[model samples]
Target: MKLIFALITGLVFGTGIAISGMMDPAKVLNFFDLAGTWDPSLAFVMGGALVITFFGYRLAWKRDAPLFGGCFQVPTGTDIDMKLVGGSALFGIGWGIAGFCPGAAIPALGTGRWEVALFLVAVVAGFYVRRLLSPAGSAKAAR
Candidate 1:
């Protein structure tokens, strides 16, 4: 049941991504272009998401646990550490270069684009490299 629910959720998310035109690298890239072919549609999509997430979190907080989990599993970290900053910068750089964040890229894989495949491969490689470089007793190792 949990797996089924997850599959349904993923499909809904992917469909939303496609409907919002987020799967198109050109559309996403245009969102970053301030002086050139700037597209404001991505801003609208993000705003819509923020509104939905705000209400969703409020409703979720009223419940003691999630429907398919024992706990909410929210992140407890609050520090503005170097690792956090660096990771965010790297993510932004990658997004600017490829116009595909990991979430959107996953669904874009169905388009049979070699760029999407390469992006996913790079993402996986990054994860492996990070795991390898992280200290044995660091918070990253706990993952």
Candidate 2:
């Protein structure tokens, strides 16, 4: 049941990304090109997602436990460090350059775009690079 739910949820999310023009690098790049032919549609898409997430979180919080867990598996780290900032900057740069973060990229690859393969490879490389560099990443050994 959990696997089914996860697959269904992922399908819905990927569908949303594709339908919203978020899967297209050109659309995202156009949004960034504010001085030229800027597409403001991405802003609306983000706003809609934010609204949905806000409400979803509120609803989730009202429950004592989630469907798959006793409590929310929230991130414990709240520190602002150079590592965090630098990693975020890199992610932002990659997203701007490719317009396909990990989630949407998978479905894009399923649609047979060769570009997504490169994007996925880069994403994996970035993950390994971070694991190699980050001090907090010693948890990998424990896992």
Candidate 3:
């Protein structure tokens, strides 16, 4: 049942991306192109998402435990240090350059887009680079 729900959720998400013209590389690239033919439409989509997520997080935290789980599995890292900032900048740079984010890229891959393969290659390269450079091992090192 959970798997079925997950599949349904993914389908809905992909459909939304398609309907929003987010699946098109041109549309996404246009949004990032400040000097060229710029599209500011994605701002409304991003704003709506941010507003919804803000309230969703607040509501979720009001519950002592998640309804689907005995306890919530949350991250304990509270410090917004240089590493976090740098990583976020790197992610944003990649997104701005490629016009493809991880979420939309998967659905794009399903459509057999070559750009998705290119994005995945970059993602894998980043993973290996992080592994080689980071002092910490995997994310579970603390655990």
The sequence of per-residue lDDT tens digits that candidate 2 reaches over residues 16-92 is 98898888888988988899989998998899999999999999988899888768766677779986787679878
The candidate maximizing lDDT is 1
Model 2 clashes, total count: 0
List RMSD in Å for every model shown. Answer: 2.1, 2.8, 3.0
Model 3 TM: 0.79
Better model by TM-score, 2 or 3? 2
Model 1: worst 10 consecutive residues (lDDT sum): 134-143
Each candidate structure's count of clashing pairs: 0, 0, 0
Better of 2 and 3 by lDDT: 2
Cα RMSD, model 1: 2.1
lDDT of 3 at 23: 70
Write candidate 3's Cα lDDT for 1-143 as tens digits.
Answer: 66787799799888877667677778888998999999987887778768987999889989998655578776788888887798889889888888888777878888887878988888888777887787476465332
Question: Which run of 10 residues does model 3 get worst, by summed lDDT?
Answer: 134-143
- Candidate 3 wrongly placed segments (more than 4 Å): 57-67, 140-143
Rank candidates, lDDT, best first. 1, 2, 3
Tens digits of per-residue lDDT, candidate 1, 1-143, equal 99999999999999989899898989999999999999989999899889999998999899988998788877788899888898889879989988999889999888888989999999988877777777563454322
